[model samples]
Target: MARNPAPFAPFEWMIAWRYLRARRAEGGVSVMTWISLIGITLAVFALIATLSVRSGFRSEFVSTILGANAHVTVYDVGRVGQQGQLDRAIADYEGWAQRVAEVPGVTRVAPLIKGQVLISLRDSSSGAEVYGIARDDLKSLPGIAQSDQAAGDLTRLDEGIAIGSGIARAIGAGVGDTVKLTSPNGVKTAFGTSPRVNAYEVVYVFSAGRYDIDRTRVYMPFAEAQAFFNREGVADELEVMVEEPEAVNALTIDILRAAGDRAQVWTWRDSAGGFLRALEVEDNVMFIILSILVLIAAMNIVSGLIMLVKNKGRDIGILRTIGLSEGSIMRVFFICGAFTGLIGTAMGVVLGCLFAIYIDPLFSFVNYVMGGGVWDPSIRGIYRLPAELNLSDVLSAVGLSLGLSFFVTLFPARRAARMNPVEALRYE
Candidate 1:
């Protein structure tokens, strides 16, 4: 009696499934299969996790930097020198600020006096950037609205000043304490030029979520800042915030036209371009390096499938003799390799997403065990490790892995399909 031909199923699929599940003793599967699967899983995990962290870091950096600074700044073309220039500039500043505020997309316009001053509390002294801004403008500043992190009321800033957490710590000054500020631009005296010195009461302490700002920024009332710097009624620059900071470039012409020829415009991107560009370059390089890792893993699939074909020579011969076509034979091995890759890719995607989501806690746990700052945020200029899982990145990684797996299987699958049944059986 004639037995069922290849179990009465699509011989290609049936053979592929059987080969995948075959025991070591039956010569169906080998250690190489598991190695390839594990390799693919690891490669996918690393790629996804790294890319997510990179994206997170970029977002955190941008937000933190912009939180402390305006999206755009308008500066006077000439320096504010004597009383005449200072008075005229101050008179024109209000009009300029009002006109700029009326421009489309302009959310807020703040006239500010910024200058470097030496801050001293007893023996300890540190150089700090002093910003004189209106109390109302504080409400519009990003990261300044977090009342939990601010020690005192910004509205109460009159003769008092607010210092950053870093500045407070550096000079051992805090709320209710007094610190001295010395300006380099001093007044001329009969005895010669004397540096302008003044004492300020620290009434508030703010954490701007940025290392540089938190470490070196001090804020005072606009009028007080102008008076302290000996440039009463004059502002050095006008800081402008927009509805959408990323689109500020599009609004440059409108802003410039509003400010007229006396003021020069500087966008946030222009100020931080070098740093942002470096980060983008680094992200691209990392992707390329991680992709190479996946390629290496894919090469393992090639070797494993080749060995699978060699070890199953007798089985291939029997299937050929039983009327399985060369096309079916090739598909059997192709499915075998593709199936392994697909399973690995699925597992990797799941694992990578989970890893990215819990990366912060995982690092904390590791740091506890290791007794060190393994993932210190201060080292990277942010407050924590951020991870933002991107779907496109995940899909790209998966597609690359599977594509490499499929491509490598072609040569080995064709070799298995083209084997002479007589020769394969005679050898077996």
Candidate 2:
């Protein structure tokens, strides 16, 4: 009786494994196999790493925008006229805010006054966008109350102002310094137009970690702004926060209904829609382009296996003579190709994840060596090149690579399987 085959040994797999390990002198196509393996590895690495970094950038940008602004804003449409109408509309803001806060998904509401002004220090002056927020409501804004870089308490702002780091640097102002604010909306006197000018001590300097915000925004107490702008009883708009920012569109309708026809609502997406849409389009294009790269790498598996089949022709004839079924022969080459793909894909996953995890430090090291601020926070509103390794992305990449590897194997494997023993040996 024939000895029992080892518990798990299958003839096809055994032969495939032996062939894969065979040296060049022993009929193994080592060079082509390695070339195929490396190609797949590099392709997968590029795919995962590029996507991860792009994901990181989108996440960081969205958070930065939300930090500096509310998810939804309600504008007083009725207040867009002469002083009497404006005063009447503003007098009803509290009731409108209360009604909006009752709307489903509405989380927080804060009234704000916004206008253009010129900020001046002893040495410098620049045009700025000034925001007047209630001191109690200041904490509702993402980066307002928690900036470690701020020199004073944002919550305690009274007659004082909190300016961005960029503004501070541009105007040469610091904590305890005084800056003059001149509103563009001025009053007309007998002589001419008089711009409303006032001085406020700089109690806090905040870095929102965003270039545009840090460069141009100034925050002061709401009541102070009302007085300074000569709109004593009114705010320009209401900043609304929702439970989920992505659901702002649906909730915007609710807010509008609750606030009445005199109010108009806009979501953060509305404010930054163009920029966000461009990012989404770019991400999709990148995926399509990188998938082509992966497909090209898969083609290498086809060439390598085709070469392998030609080199192993004599062995194929011998194995066929020994009663190896055609299906078994096909499976042998299929397994060989698949094994190469699996190894390369596994390696690529490891390499990609490691690269993403250490991306920040790697960039820092390169920047230090190059003696340049290649990843400028001031330019992108981010301190580093962010990377987020999504598990689905990794899994999708693996599935795609393996599917391509398995698919490319079919033709060469079928050719090897259909070899007539006589014809195969005739050449040998």
Candidate 3:
């Protein structure tokens, strides 16, 4: 007698064709198979697309933080409550700047004195955050390159200031306009203390795309800040630039130790803890909730295979009688179920990537349909929302969904394989 070929056979097409033929003979593809395919397809699409969107959102948040804040912030945390020595602060800044530059990944360092102050021009008055900066110190800040330049070297100006685009528009001020500023003295003026105030001309307006900053940031000279605020020598914060934003936490610790209590050190995350935590929580919750779509689709695979098992009971019984082993029978069902999942996931991955790639245009379309949309990058004062797609994110989503689909069908496939040959044959 001729030896039977391996139970699964050598040709994949043969096995697939057998399945197709069987499917057609049994009144064509069953409703269960159609449902299962669509379910898996939709699940895969939703999971992939949702993950891509979440990834986009997370990146947008990171970009916003980086644009609005420095990578590392250094400030006095001494018992003195604050430090106020321009010469001392500059000396310390130069020393720390050199040392920080020596550290691996250190890119650049910038000095700033940040404080809240009352700003008034003519009859219009508003509260704003005043950032006293040296032109050299803030030149590398994102979007600074786009600022309008004045006649003299920026750092050389003793009392010049830069306003955010929003602030300029709001106050109806422009270059050459003079404004008065007042800041609290850290003590009541009536207690033999006087708040500091000064007059300065608007030099340039910088738009950093952070709406809040664009609407409220005021940049002036370091000396001017001291004269206006009565704190001449000390800096409220030092902004350190880094090669990689992710290394900020480690660098903050190292910088703190180096500064030795002259100031508290902070990372972007520390400065924006509440927002970061909220974003993280939202990402996790969204990921978990969306995963249900894939899970539901996996369940459909199980149901479809169960229906196949019931319909093909006679075929399975005949094959077993002809010497096919239980393991081989199981492989057939597993292949069928896995194939369905594979096809759905592949399609979903393609569509998901397409969606991410064209997200901006799609949003624009929605905006156009709605009759109007936000265009100013400085609304709240800065640029528009940013988005990016990371390959790792896509790979992770597809890998997870495919793995889940396979695992979910394993037991069902085994159940069909383990059916007793005698019992299956006895049916009908």
Return the top candidate by TM-score: 2
Q: For residues 16-117, could you state the per-residue lDDT of candidate 2 as single tens digits?
A: 888888899987888888988999999899999998999889888888787778899888666335545443235567888999999989888888888899
lDDT tens readout by residue for model 1, 6-72: 5224766777988888888988565888888999899998889888888888888888767878899
lDDT score of model 2?
Answer: 0.85
Compared with the true structure, all predictions reach lDDT values of: 0.85, 0.85, 0.70
Residue 197 of model 2: what lDDT? Answer: 92
Give the runs in model 3 whose Cα sits over 4 Å from its true position: 1-13, 17-25, 78-105, 120-125, 146-159, 172-201, 370-387, 420-428
Model with the higher lDDT, candidate 1 or 3: 1
Estimated TM-score per prediction?
0.92, 0.93, 0.80
**Sorted on TM-score, highest at the top, how do the candidates line up?**
2, 1, 3
Off by over 4 Å in 2: 1-9, 78-89, 376-379
